[model samples]
Target: MTGFEGKTVVLTGAAGGIGRDLARAYAGRGAAVLLTDLSGEAGEALARELNEAGGSASFFPADLAQPEAAGLIMEAAVRTFGRIDILINNAGFGIWKPPLELSVDEWDAVLNVNLRGTFLCSREAAKVMKRQAQGGAIVNIASTRAAQSEPNSEAYAASKGGIVAITHALALSLGADRIRVNAISPGWIDNGKFGELRPEDHAQHPAGRVGRTADIARACFYLTDPDNDFVTGINLTVDGGMTRKMIYEE
Candidate 1:
């Protein structure tokens, strides 16, 4: 945990459930965290909370849909923390509708933020990390939907699938620079409604419950840990074994 002491992390989509916890995890571990999101209010509040608790944290408002946002975000991080040691792409949204009704605009919106944003941010961070002697780590927050689908998830699935593809490709390209790239595909992570989940909901998962933000946070720590440098160019599924179980009606 203290391994992150004195490190700098840039995290996107940091106002939401998973993103918020991810921000805390990094800040709590001694990383000077730059939290970015569309919600400036939330981002600022979280940053304030972390700083009040004696952790180094700051907030930057951004809309990944904008082509210029990535560069600005990376700049803000470097300006605040002096260097980029970790980048977490955790910002994404989905537009669910019948595939026939899913307009090109909707699809574009999803890809722009989920897939394109991931790529742009990684590229910008890599530019900085490459200059540093130790290099850095990038963890893209993909989803289980990248591989499995429920219904009417074409755009969402496509974006996540693209994340996985770019993850390995970036890994291969950045290996020589000592920058490790990886992806985490989370399955059914309960944001804040765990109390409302029914018995069957927990039973359905092979792990006996829905996943928490902490689960993905732990995975992030593991992947970015310098000791685990051997781990790269892979997608680690953090689902509660839901992807492994075969579901069928009796």
Candidate 2:
């Protein structure tokens, strides 16, 4: 494992499916983790467990929907773990509805969490990194659904599309400050805790099997490595070639 010794990482959605796995993966590499989630108790428990296991971790509670939550989480991270080296904006939300059927509130909810929240976290992290003169990495967890047609998913799709845009835009703006920003478009990752995907979801993919939390988490770890300074402004598709599959008319 790449040693992230003494590196501090702040991860959002740390209590969720992929988020939890990402936290463990980072800690395993010797990084001190600041785990944030809406579930206060769960986040605390997970952080405590990692600490007890000889890894450094701390729990921070925040509702990503709130504008202040992002700043709060980052501030807490800096206070607890010192300067942050990596930030994984992995908090995600989705509501299945067609454009016409989607309520404005639903659209705003998805955008607020998936897009605005990412903006907040990265903005705060950039300020810290720029001041410290230490380059940092940010990994935004988008989804394959961004480019594909998932019926009744207008809001989610738009939000993810925004992530791809945000990653590159921020990457360019932050490049001068020595900060790298990238996004990961995950496939159908079956965490067995939340979310859903029938067997049919996997049959169409070239991988022939649904992805797991570990797959996405592994990618996040790589993107956030301090030793990795060359990679930036990439929307990495970890969707098992599903995006390239030819689904021509029969």
Tens-place lDDT digits, model 1, residues 1-250: 4469989999999997999999998888888999999955889999999999999998999999998999999999989989999999999999999999999999999999999999999999999999999999999999999999989999999999999999999999999999999999999999899999999999999999999999999999999998889999999999989899987899
lDDT per residue for candidate 2 within 118-219, as digits (tens), equals 999999988888877677999999988888866898888888999999999999999999999999999777788334676777777799878888888778
Q: Candidate 2 versus the native: TM-score? A: 0.93
User: Where does candidate 2 stray beyond 4 Å?
Assistant: 193-203, 248-250
lDDT of 2: 0.88
TM-score of each: 0.98, 0.93
RMSD of each: 0.9, 2.3
